[model samples]
Target chain A: MDIFDGIATGFATAATAQNLLYVFIGVLIGTVIGVLPGLGPSATIALLLPLTYTLEPATAVIMLAGIYYGSMYGGTITSVLLRLPGEAASVVTSIDGYEMARQGRAGAALGISAVGSFIGGMVAVVGLMLLAPTLADIAVGVGPPEFVALAVLGLLLVTYLGTRHPFKSLAMAGIGLLLATVGQDPITGATRFTFGQLSLIDGFDFVAIAMGLFGVGEILHAIEQDQAVKALTSKVRNIWPTRQDFRDSAAPIARGSVLGFLIGVLPGGGGVVSSLASYGAEKKLSRNGRHEFGKGAIEGVAGPETANNASSTSAFVPLLTLGLPSNVVLALIFGALTIQGITPGPTLIDDHPDIFWGVIASMVIGNVILLILNVPLVGVFVQLLRVRPGILGAFALLITMAGVYSINNDLNDMWVVLGFGVLGWLMKKTGFEPGPLVLAFVLGPILEGSFRQSMLLSDGSLGIFVQRPVAGVVFGLIAVFLVWSTVMALRGRLTSGAEMIEHAAADEAELEALRSPAAPEQDRADADGGGDARATTRTTTRSRHEEED
Target chain B: MSQHAYRFGALAILALGAAAALGAVQLGLGGLSAPGSGLWPFITALVIIFCGLVLIVEDTPDDYETWTRRSGKVGIAFVALGVFIPVLQLLGIILAAFLLLTFWIRFLSREPWRLTLVLAVAGSVGLYLVFGQFLEVPFPVGIIGRQTGLEFGL
Candidate 1:
């Protein structure tokens, strides 16, 4: 369908009273939860998945899409005010955003962020409207081998690019794939690993596992942190950016929109990566140079906020066109659609125009709602941080249990939720991010099924993976990425060795400074508090090390 | 946790990889074209084993959060979650949630009894109104609901 017709159909379907109510609820809940530390879009969506079981597929997806991007907007509020990045994407924003708040420009910072995010989100929607149908058309004829390529590429991209520890991420992905193989064999109808249990016959319930890993796990972890959240409740004034602030931020807003849209289309390239990349670009290329960075720079906040929001919208392209979810949040959305018996792929637009178009239309409307709601209600949302973490965690835990139980009313699923929740907490404590694992679990079946089919089609010739043009190109790109990553790892190792030496010298210098009688008054006061100069030096050094990492 | 602790985690995953591979083998690994259920799993198990080995050998990443006395709260929290299932079966969701919320707020958060009671009561009723009454989620009626004849879910 053409863009205009599809959009018209979308608005017609999405503008219904029921759909509008859900859209508002989703974004509002998304923003509120996003303002709370440690409760991200993924967990919120997982907790709410049971509510979607009875809704129309289009409505469910529309609400989920709103939650996904709405959280992006909401995360910035905490990052700016409290410097307590609520979402990963807002971490960069915290640098300049918190500084702006300290400088009493919190209102201008938030105002510009909302305006930039709106523009970015709008640009991405237009891009999606223009690009998705064409991409879907191109992907319509792809077969099993091509599917294998896409799945592998998506998995590899996410693990390699989306994680700090590639080996750990890959191991987690392997575990996820193994878990996906727990039920009956797709082809032979032979139970692979059910252990003779009836509940195992369906393998693991996606909702249960998701709620466990993200929802329960995150709450368990969040409860470990200090519960006393110091709030910056000072009323923000000067709500609009001055003319000079607008002039400085205008170029960055435009640049970030385009940059984010392009990056978001790539597998594993949205959210934090897009925002960080935009921040880096602005820092290097801005006419103001680097002096203004980390000191209430309007461009720093404007660029990243726009980029992250834009990227969140554009990330939908892959899922809609190729049935490939680029990140963990998108994977949960994929699971939701699959539960509703709707497979997202090249034929989605043709098969379910309402779902495809209605969701896209809802995003445009949701962004408008976020802008309208955020500007005036930023103060209201910030108050959510005042709610005790224990109370919030208790409520979140209850919702998780009730939500998972509602799915099939099976007690076994609750056990799964508890077990995975523990595993998730352990993973977090051990420096393993569960994002790749969840994404891999969702993609596991497609990868295995297509891989087997491709082998059969080629009469057991493994070369079939590279014989098709699309698959061949994908494999070639994967090889290039592997080689490049290896080179970078080696370079990083060498540089880290030098960095370790520098750190040792800095530690020595810090110790000397602490011991010197001519030390600064603050250092003397700190020394007097403990009267253990080595201890003071050690604490400072450790914090500096953590900051550098 | 130290690097030694991470090594143990790697070893555990390595053991799991071995066990999964054995299970896959038992499931029967056919050829590439006409594969059995075990083929994909076996390959994945091998990849897992390889990753585990790499993690064991390489310098561990320094991103882990160090556990402190505060981590004991997580243990207490898990115990509460563990008790919830039986409580849910015995008293239905509303009472179970009330008790759980009260424990979390009054004990874990160290809040005043009045605030804990207020939040616990309000939260439980609100959850029931939404999940049981509105959404009809079919939660267990339990001993109390059955004796009182007060079923509230689909």
Candidate 2:
């Protein structure tokens, strides 16, 4: 019948006690991981991927969806309380959220974010329920060439949103694609890059690499740096938002939801770009005299938080419609779908309407669950770091290792985790973002496959890309992005060079400030962590030193 | 000669990846077959290698002494992983995991035995329930469990 009636059917399937329980569990577990520093959706989903084997396809996807969106709900807690981001997507949250905490408006900010995120998530789920099947129906007519063009466009959009570092992002993505290639040829029955380990025969398990790169890698970096974030006392002066705060945040939340959902529909688009774009949007809409954007602004928290949630929910669009996933996390869910013998494309609704509709309804359920679970537990989460970082770190490593081993029961998988963990640790130290690398690796193989198949299908004629209307539009977008990124990169390089020279000229003044007693506290603690008094002194000293420098 | 040679290092890796990919292509012409799986996997490698070459050629280096200092923590993490491999097969999956968790939590995170033991046991049992019983995937039984598989109905 109608889309709403379809969603009603979805609600009936998703409302069953068994399915509701799964959503609750998924959201709770996801929120916990999201609250913890470095425990992100990709790693958590990867670690839990094995357990989905027995679940009904619909049940498993609903649960996975719960976890994916649930993380967005919990991410703001750490960002606001400890000034530590639980995931890269939440980095923007810390800018205003912690500032609000510093200004004694932590409770209000948290309230706004929780409610804002809920609204955003609900809006996107509605989009998914309405749009996914319609899009899948439309995609039915597309050929290999169209898919390849769409994939190229996805890569370009992801790379473009990758900001001034599109080259690095593209490189990481390219490398990831190559890594995806390291398995046996399914059709030709030839070993491509196994280098002879039997486990390598199936190629690398996505779970293993996700664990190695996202989970184990993050733990290694967290431990290696040994930086303990300070927890904020719940000095939530205001629990409810003021009328002014609500008025200011309403339009931004609505805008973020629309922007985030649209952006997330594109392949490889997720947390980073959504957050950044939301921040940019908020900044652009600022009042004339309000230049206080970077130091801490409420719009910054409200916009990004809403955007991240909406985007997270909308990510299901491609996975559900095209039978293709844009990121590693969705890829794992796709693998789960494959195990259940249901391909994820245009035929999903036609063949299995229950599966498609049930998941969309479950998102609505999961968002409600997350709101219930996260708000009350915010107090517990805010103070989590009060427990020794060392103790938490040990448990994190153990769980991560155990999870990694469970993935394939292969020691080599654990070794891979260690290798990437070390690399991640190094990258963190070196100011390189590892998120793009992992994202790259996930999308790499699929893009290559799509591109090559399109070429082969048209007998190596580049004209095939433009021949299809959809494909042409997608490629046109890619061309624009490529051109824009090139110009931006050149400008960025020049500006950075200029900035570096300016810094070099001011080096002596910075050195004097560093030696000064009033230097910033984190830098002072960086030298030594003798006691509380010492730490406070260090922070104070560093701030003053920073001022002089 | 630059302070950070990572660009060169990255380039070297890229060069190596490219050379390896060329060798990979010699084995197949990339899927003329059903799903065309070969086309994507094979060509992706070539792109990565090319990008690696670009990264190397356009490399930028930075001072990196801080990374070298955390060798102790890194060493322990790797060693813990090495210990886990042989243990899962010899010891029971639950016992092996418990032991692995204990060492990692107790030593790596440097927590007390009380906390580590509880976490280790909880983790193993949770894992057994999910991956083994619920999923119905047989975990690798230890020598002891294997010898007594049917007896315990494992």
Candidate 3:
């Protein structure tokens, strides 16, 4: 395991001023975009992808990878303060963070999320440094059925990630999967849902759809609710967590890091699930039945934020090792690699040690830079929120259009972005998620091509999916989750009437608990006042605000 | 009066998607007699349509009172998007895109128009430099062509 040799060699390449500078800049930009409401890493990468075209493939890969993790951490800032989630992965932060805000613990919540993210990320990176070779060795053995089942499970996990209501989350994911099918067919190389337009030939450009859904859609949502969680609240106090806060978060952070790393190593899972799952696990592990969950549980914020960063870092393993991409950002990074004519797989280590190790070294450097930048630069990012949504949205729209056009010198791609932008906005409001859509889009071709290739190898038998024991196990896990989700859904309908009031209140209350202090509460209270004016209100209100839907 | 028109809308969309997928498969890909590229397209569409149907049929939504409270901007945005497509060649990709984005930002939001215009222009310029000049990929160029790359000091 020449770990020292690998690290030393990686340093020689990654330490170059140009590569280092790009990695730092990429991490910085990624964090800034992640802090903002709209642009998460996928859009951030798409926006930056064109700029990197001139750089060495290794440098480009390193920078893009830096952005992915940087954004993962950056999202926590908004999730903690604004009670407005910056990215889908950061949504869990708002669950406890906003609650902590309402409880006047926003500072502690923010501090915990940051510290936890740092710990989780560092731990995961170290894990990757130690474990990637072995994992990659195993990953090389996975075949097509494994990927297909993994994709299905990945999308399903994301679909069920909704905190307010599981059903809505599943539906959103289903819609995302459907959207993925909008592009060219992998097996036949024929375009679907493109309506015969030349632009449609390639299927939906991921850039277009990503920018539309996560970027533009978020902007629209932000515009509609331009008011911040703290718009009317007092400035937060106690920026540092107390010793007690550390005591509470210590276990959860460690648990989250390990849990997140494991989940992230899986085919479909990534930071979002790891973070969310960690939070739930943390809550369950707590002895207090701590009402702090929606009311400012520092552990809640810290655990999930850490898990998110850790998972983002671990995602690189499969991507670099097996040529597997669980999410869109990795897919884009893969796209960058393919553009440069380099294939990412187990042999990559031997073929391009400079690139692989350089990327690894750069990841460490990028995380260090982010930890330094995330807190001190908090003011600058928050100020971005002050940039009128109109201005930001307009600029984002323009950048998307021109960027797509300039890339291919094609008007068709621009039109595709605009079209997806419209769909993105609608999906946002309608409870459809853009995450699964992206996964589906990126993997559809890979899945189909691999399936056909495997069939040809096996002479068209169903045995291909179960040929390898490891692949069989992975598919079996997916089957369990599918059945579990199905049972949960059916049970939900059966028990619906009993928990109606309780179910509805969880979301509203979580919003209330996560509030900065004065704003959302007054508005929410006023909205709910009409219903409460008559009967004994506290009990009904309490029931309405259950922790889970 | 629940605002969950999404439940019904989802089903309708699923049907349409499935039909399209089915139709595309029949159209075949590059050649009529061969396996054709269209086969995969149709299958993908079928996958989506099937999943959509499963989701819609499985989950019965609540009422629509909440849906009405929304500003109703989604439909308007859709209309604007439909119009933005053909308008591209007329104004050139850059100019048309700039206009569409600026209009969307200005009208869709409550902020001042100047900021929106500035954002649109700067964003377009950044894209021009990054994608066009820096990356050396080209766009339709509109009135300026690749010559615009020089003006940006690229």
Candidate 4:
């Protein structure tokens, strides 16, 4: 369909009462889940996936997509008021946002975040509208060799860029790939690891594993943390920012929208990465960034928040057009789409334009709903912190069990959920992230299937990978990335023990900035004198250590 | 985390890789031209083993969280859920979930008894209303209902 025709159709599809209701429910649940300390977009979506089984395909996707970006707006509230990130993407926001809250400018920080998120989301929607169709056109002619290249590159990028310990992440991904081989071989009908169980013939349930790993696992892990949270309540009087605040944030928001849009198009480059990169760029690029970064800088709050929201919107481009999920959240949406018997790829736009454009259009409306909800109901969402984490954990566990069981009406799925939940908890305590693992699990079939196709087509010649131009370019990119990562890893290892200790100390102080309201003052003072050096160190540490969504 | 933690994780992965590799070999690894069912799995197993060895040789980073006294609660929660699944068949979802929720809220979470009772009842009934009734999830009617001749949201 043409762009204008798609837009009109999208509006027609999304404007119905049923679609609007789903959108409202999606954003509302997303906002609530985001406001709560433990649940993130991934877990929430995984928990709700089975429930979407009965809905229309377009409506289901529109709602799930709404939750993904709406959470971006909801996440800023906790960051600003409580100094606790509602999700990983909002971690950077807590640095300057909480500082602003302490100075009685909480409203200004939140207001700028809301305004910037709206602008960023809208801009990204426009980008997606224009870019995805063209990308899909280009992808239509791509063969299995390119598919192998793309999947391999994507897996490598996520492991290399998503975590600090590349070896561990790679191992997790390897495990995920192995897990994907459990049911039956795609080429041959022989089972690889079913172990004689009838249910094993179908392989493990994706919904069950996801809900277990992210939902049950997170709740189990969350219960172990310090549950005390304090929201700055007295100083939230004015909801609008001062004119100077707007002036300071305007440039950052624009820059963040552009930066986030570009980054989100790349695999493994959204959520935390987008926000952290934006924060780092704003710190280096903004005029007064050096002085204002850790001390109630509206620019600092505006940049990361705007970037994360924009990245969330634009991350849809890969999933809709290429059938490659750029992050874990998109992976869940991909699962949801598969459950509805719809394959998302280059043909998706042609096959299901209503779903493709309806989802995109719903995001435009969802962003508007988020803006309206955040501006007026910020305090109400803040009050959700009072609901207590323990209570939330119990209910989440119940829902997870019920939801997973309902998927196939089979009790074996519950076993899978509990097994993965424990494994997820254990993984968390050991500093192993499940993001790469889950993404690899979703991509494994595609990678393996394409690889076999390429091999068969070429009569076992390995030259097939580099024979195609697109595949050649992708492999070349992968090689460059590998070399760069090795160099960085070597450099990291070569640092003196004392330097490593110093970096670790600086990292602790940054963590302290998130945990304690009083700590930012010391952090600000440190930032004021030689903060750039420490800031660089902190950015490197976070990029390596922080969890990618 | 301690060096011991890193060693343990690496060893576990290495063992898993070895087992999977054995399974793949038994399944028959075919040539490159006509791959067998085991070809992809064997390759993945090798990658896992390689990653494990790399991690074993590397210096341990002090980034992981260690278990505290409070971590027992996670174990307790896991065991309870494991038991709850079977009990769900015996007592049905409503009664089984009620009991589980009560135990979790009252004991595991250490909330007030009054609050625990209220939340457990509300949570169980609410789940039935949503998943069992509204969504028609077809939850099992357990021994309790079978004997009592009462079907609760089946």
Best by DockQ: 4
**lDDT (10s digit) by residue, model 4, range A211-278:** 88777877787777555445345467688888888888899999999988988888876766677778
Predicted candidate 3 versus true structure: per-residue lDDT over A1-549, tens digit per residue: 377788888888999999999899888877777665435566567665545656898899989888778777776776666555555566567667866876788778777777787888888888887888776667667676666666566555444432223444444444444455565666554456677677566555556666665555544544443322234242456767899889888888999889888877765557656765787787767647444566567777888888888888887887778776766667678767866778787777778888878898888788778777765666667666555544554566555555566666676666666666666555544544454565555566666566556556666665766766766776777778668767876776422211221222245665444333322111111100011000111112223333222
Could you report the DockQ of all the candidates, in the order they appear? Answer: 0.62, 0.36, 0.28, 0.65
TM-score of each: 0.90, 0.82, 0.77, 0.91
Give the root-mean-square deviation of each candidate in angstroms. Answer: 7.2, 6.8, 7.6, 5.8
Candidate 2: stretches off by over 4 Å: A163-165, A184-191, A195-201, A227-229, A288-297, A387-449, A492-549, B1-5, B28-42, B63-65, B112-114, B117-154
Of candidates 4 and 1, the better by DockQ: 4
lDDT of each: 0.79, 0.64, 0.61, 0.78
| Steric overlap count per candidate | 0, 10, 19, 0
In model 4 chain A, which range of ten residues has the least summed lDDT?
A524-533
Per-residue lDDT tens digits for candidate 2, residues B1-154, read 5555556547655775676667665765544433344556556566667667655555454322244555577677667767766777677567776777787778767778898888878877776665566654445678777776631212
TM-score of 2: 0.82
Fraction of true contacts retained by every candidate, in order, equals 0.84, 0.37, 0.27, 0.84
lDDT per residue as tens, model 2, A47-70: 566567657889988888787777
What does the lDDT come to for candidate 3? 0.61
User: Between which residue pairs do clashes occur in model 1?
Assistant: none
**Candidate 2 lDDT score relative to the true structure:** 0.64
